[model samples]
Structure formats: C-alpha cells, structure tokens
Target: MDAVAKEIEGLTFNMLTFNVVNDKITQGFANRIIQIIEKHNIDQVIVIADEVEEPAQFLLNLASAARSICISQTCASYWGGEPLFLGAHELSWAPGMFERKMDKLFIDNRLFLEFLDTEDIKMLRERLPKIDKKIWFASTCLIHGLYGLNYENNGCVVQSCISDGNEVERGLISITHSSRQDERFKSLVKLREYHFIPYPALACYIEY
Candidate 1:
C-alpha cells in the first residue's frame, strides 16, 4: 500500500488508500494506523463507521486510547418520533456504556444521503478547525459520500475497505501539488499488506 503526503497552503495533507482483503479490521491493522498518526503528528483523529461491528468497536477503542474523537451511525430502532434524516441520536462523553472505551457519538443516517449538509457533517466541519491538522479514519463505504465534506474542510481522510471487500472504489482528491516521497510515507507503505496506490481523484456525487 502507498502513503502520499503533500503540503498545500501551509496545510499538510496525507492520504493512505488500501483494500482490506476481507471484511476484517484486525488489531494489527488498527495499530498500524496509530503508528501513522504518530508518524504524521496528526493533531485530531476522527473515526466514522455507520455500524458498530466487532472490528469497528475495536478500532474505536484503540482510537479512544489514543485520544481520538469517534463518531458512528446508530441503528434507528431506538428513535421515538418521526425519523430525522440528518442528525445524531445522541452525543455522549462517557465511556463503557457504548461497546467502546471512549465517548460515543452516534448519528442517525437511516435515510443516508450523498450530501454534505447533514448535521454530522456540519459538526465535523466545526470540530475540524480546532486542530490545524487532522486525519479521518472512516469506512470505505462512506468515503464516497464524505469526500466532498472533507475536501471542503481541508482534512486528510483514510479508510479501510471493511464493508467494500478488496476493491477500493474511490480516492480522495486535493488540488495541491504532487505528493512527496518521504521516510514516513515509505513506512506507511511497509505497514500495510495490501497493494497501495497514491492519491487519485475520483468523482463522487454530492447533493447540495
């Protein structure tokens, strides 16, 4: 796998894209991500997974241990009123109640849309500016929908193809110069067993 880093207008953006052979995210994989965070000096970490599967739970716990901000989409069975399509069910700061050891912020994406106007997206954009540089660890399935939001906010996005199997469908794009090959980037490539490709801009539809 390849890790690409580029500096744009004083902001450092790094992109790591790889396929997850199977629908599994092992501890080894999560640890490698942590190493990348440290290697890049990531100031903020965002984990976005729609479902709290066993592997996703583990990743969340690990990210929390590293003091990362975690957000996941929750099942809609617990909603009491007319379902809202663009907001979170709850944002909790305590740990242990959820399957993870960190704060549990759950969004309701039952009527999931490929738009950048959702409350969670807004929340993400708001929180991103707090850190000068940040990285996002999201589900590959959600990357298509989130790319626009991440680009507009100027944050690095990373994802493993857990739900999408071994095919990585899209790549994050930046209007910056070509990526620079550095020691950290080489280490990231060595950390992954999957074949890595540097950043490639793929078109995604984003509703207004």
Candidate 2:
C-alpha cells in the first residue's frame, strides 16, 4: 500500500477515493485496516480521500455522533469559501443573515432536496446507521426552527455551547486572530469531547 493508504488504514476510517489515478487497494491496506480495528474499540468510522478537482463531497458523510471530525484540506493550503454547510442539515445551506421579528426569528429551510441523492444516503445509512444524526454547525447558525433536515428527525441540540432547543443551523461567528479575546470559542473548547468541523477562514479556530 502507498503511504497515504497506510496512514488511512492506521486511522481505521473506511477509505474512498475521488478522481485519483492510483486506485489500488493492496493486501497491505486490508491487513493494516484489520490490525488497527483489532487494536481499537471502534464503533463506527468513514474516511474519504479526494484527489480530483471536484469539491470535497466526502465531508457529507462525516460522523455526526462523533465528538471530533478531522479534515486534512489538500485543496489550497489555506481554507476560505462558501460559509454554507455550517449547519445540522444534510445537503442544505443556511441563509446569509437571520431576520428576527416579534421575538421569533424567520429562518427558511433552503433545502435542495434534489441534492438528497438517495443512493448516497442509503450507502451511508448502510455503513453508518447513525450518520447525520447531529451536524457540527457553527454556534452562530442557531436560529429557531432552522435546523434544516436535523429538525425533521428530532429537533436538535447544540454541543460545546449553550444548549438551545431551537432548530436553527447557526450564525454564531468564531473569533479569529486574538485567541485571548475569543470567549465563545474558548467556552466551546471547554466542553467535553466537542464536534470539530472546519470553515475555510475559521479553520484556525478549531484548537484540536
């Protein structure tokens, strides 16, 4: 197996390739995967490696129940683009600004159900039953009844932040540059085993 495949096997997360020419799954890869699985008490995992010009769609299969989700961005050494996908919904994006009126906020469900590719969802459900249970959206995306698809399941809960029953995706911005001045991000880190999702420019904020 190649170095990349070996490292992936060591992590014990299932591997999928995108637009990569070397599509060889060597015996070494299978052996290493078994060894890692035997060594750890793992419940579920899904890992994806992308080598194409296409967007990183593998992120859509992230383990929501997991306390932390790690992404090694190979696109541009820096991260920044489309503040969307920072919510608890599958194949959905949050609005730019939330309008609040009469103590109740108006957050629309801008769902592209056409993006709900049933085959992909089925594949994920088969591999990881608890997929997309709770998403790692930004604390800012929290607007009432704005949880996109996550709400359809069972409302939603915010981890590592204030526990609000609202279904909004989030709009809580992360403080950048001054690590000392960012109380909200600091508080989030204090929570036990919080989920880790990365925004392009805000990727630096995730301590772990």
Candidate 3:
C-alpha cells in the first residue's frame, strides 16, 4: 500500500473544463470545480466560465487552488478587481470558435498555466499578441497557412508537452516531417517557420 501511494504521488495532471451557460457564475459552481479537482488529484486546471457578474469575487474565491484562470472578454467590466497578473486577458474571439474546437481552448489555457509554472512571463507577454493566431488549433489547413505567415515573422513557436524533452523533439520533428508529405501540414509550414521548440526539450524559453 505504501509503495502504491508513492507511485501515485508522482502522478499529476493539468485539467480543463468549461461551464458554458447564460446564467451568472456562482460560488456553488466554483466549489463544485474544487471538488472535481480533488477527486482526480488534479495539479492544475483552466476554468472557463462565461458571463460572470462578479468576476473579482469569483476569482478571489478561487484564489486558493486555481493556478491559472481565464474569463471571457465580454466579462471585462466585472474583472475590475486586482489582477493576479496571471495572463488575465480578454477572450475577444468568437465563442462559436471555441465551441467547435474545444481542444484549442484547452491548449490556449494550458499555455498560460505553462508560462506561470515555468516563470516565463516575459516570453508569454512578448508572444501574447501572436498567440491568438498560431496557437489556435484550426479545423482547416488554409487557416494554418494564413496563421503560419504571422508565425514566421514572429520567429519560432514554442509550446509545452506532457512528455520528456526528447519526446517533445520527436513529436515536433514528426510534424515537420509530415509537413513535407502532407498537403495540409505542408501548407502550414510552407514558410519553414515550422521551426519550433517543444520544451522541456529546449528546457527554457530563452532557447526559443
């Protein structure tokens, strides 16, 4: 039992969940989120709730566990509370966009968590404007190609992964390899701006 517990101790995961509704975000909803996290031993989470009225209080209530949080751009007025400087940004993009491709929201939210966890604030800030286009997981290659143009001018794309450094490298290299053979992937990296650092392979944002 002790050995099993030890093994479990090493396991942790970043989670993402959305409460998409027209009603205001409430404390009960927040509590339920905490319950779910504890139940799964979640290390971190990205809570995406929409149309929160008291954004400040809602966030403050979650101050204990929510390592990285995001509210919709439409909720801007309610966010007048003290900002945690935790990548608190306006979700100015169309809701339908995220509704269709939820994985992109998960990735975008986790990117903020990674920046906070790795203390790569400067890189995040510098790349913030560019993220909306490149990091967004589009449903089509045409979108990827259009965004790839901006990605090249901005330099390299760096992102976090669940695996070790070498694995990250292999994954990225695989993508580049596919770019050569797959028409969609090919257009995405046409500029060769596909140069990317899948850290912890690069180990630090400075290397990007």
Candidate 4:
C-alpha cells in the first residue's frame, strides 16, 4: 500500500491507490484511508472505482467508512447496495444526463470525448469561459494527454494502473496548478516497475 498527503491551497488532499487483491486487503486499505482522513481531519473525500460489482462494492465500503462523497460514470443511486454516507454525484457530459440531484459536478477526458462529437467539442470550448464552477478532469494516466486542461486554480487527481510482468500496481498522482512547474513533482510522472507478483496471481495470468 502507498499513500501521499499534501496541503493544496487550504485543503488537505490524501491520495491513495492500490491493487485490489482480495476482500481482506481491500478492507484493510479502507481502514488505512479512514486513518488518513482522521489523522489529517480531511473534510471531503472522493472515491472513484470501476463499475464492476466487486470494485463498486469495495468503493462503497471505503466511502462509507470514511463518510466521504463519491463520483462515477453512473449515479450512486443506481449502485444499489448499502446507502452512501454523504450522497454521490455522477460525472456527465450530456445535457440529458444532468440531474437536479447532482450538487457537484466534474468532467473526465474519456467520458467527454465519448459523449461529444466534433461540433459539440467546439461549442463546449466556446462556452467554457462562461461557466463559473471549476471543472475537474480525471484520467487513467496523467502523462497521457489532458494533463493541463484543468482550470488554473483547480487541482487534478489521476489514478493509474501499472503492470510489471505478473504484478499489477495502481497509484494516484495528485497535481495542482501551483505544483505544475515544480521539478520534484514533475519527476513522479514516470513508469513504475514492481518486482514481486501478488499472491492472487499465482493461480492464473491476470491481464490488465
């Protein structure tokens, strides 16, 4: 498990990412996130996970434990399981998908392009300046395109997966406008290699 904490502006941001091995490990990771939230007195928490049943369940467990909010491609109301603590928001680019329940909203590169065509993209660019709220961009890898598209005052959290031989590792890279030019922060945008294979992979080959 790996974790990093940084204070951006006046808010404390705790970023954590890890491979999902089993229920035990996921529960432990949830506990670790809770510990970090308590230690730092973090007020806002955002948990993003794939739409798969197991991962979504794990995401709910972590969010429930931390009493934090969640954002995903689908609405939390559709996640249907244990109730969320602080409610949830869906990331949407289409006007029809927007709901009154969504108090906070953000956009991601994958979803933006998938939903919008050439003309839509151009129109969005023209009207972007008129929007008042800061739009956050979430990506699988920061080194890919969409690194600097976020508003100058807003920060971005990128969760990426790295596969090294049979071992798979996931990590979160948090970057703010203030730290964009810092050499130390820029150095983190490199490929990571892990030596040992996780125990769950011993029985079969897991393709990332």
- Whose TM-score is greatest here? 3
Q: Write one digit per residue (lDDT tens) for candidate 1, span 12-69.
A: 5343322242233455655665565556655334433322334434444454443333
Cα shift from native, residue 61, model 1 (Å): 4.7
Local lDDT at 208 for model 2: 26
Q: Candidate 3: which stretches are off by over 4 Å?
A: 1-13, 74-208
Q: Which one wins on lDDT?
A: 1
**Local error of candidate 4 at residue 113 (angstroms):** 8.1
Task: Sort by lDDT, best first.
Answer: 1, 3, 4, 2
Q: How accurate is candidate 1 locally (lDDT)?
A: 0.32
lDDT (C-alpha, whole model) for all candidates: 0.32, 0.26, 0.31, 0.31
lDDT of 3 at 162: 33
Q: Tens digit of lDDT per residue, candidate 2, span 20-103? A: 222322334434433443344333322222122222222222222222333221221122332222222243211111110111
- Give candidate 3's whole-model lDDT: 0.31
Question: Model 2, which residues run further than 4 Å from truth?
Answer: 7-52, 61-136, 139-208
Q: What shift in Å separates residue 205 of candidate 3 from its native position after superposition?
A: 11
Which candidate, 3 or 4, has the higher TM-score?
A: 3
Global fold similarity of model 3 (TM-score): 0.29
Number of the candidate with higher TM-score, 1 or 3: 3
* Number of clashes recorded per candidate: 2, 12, 1, 0
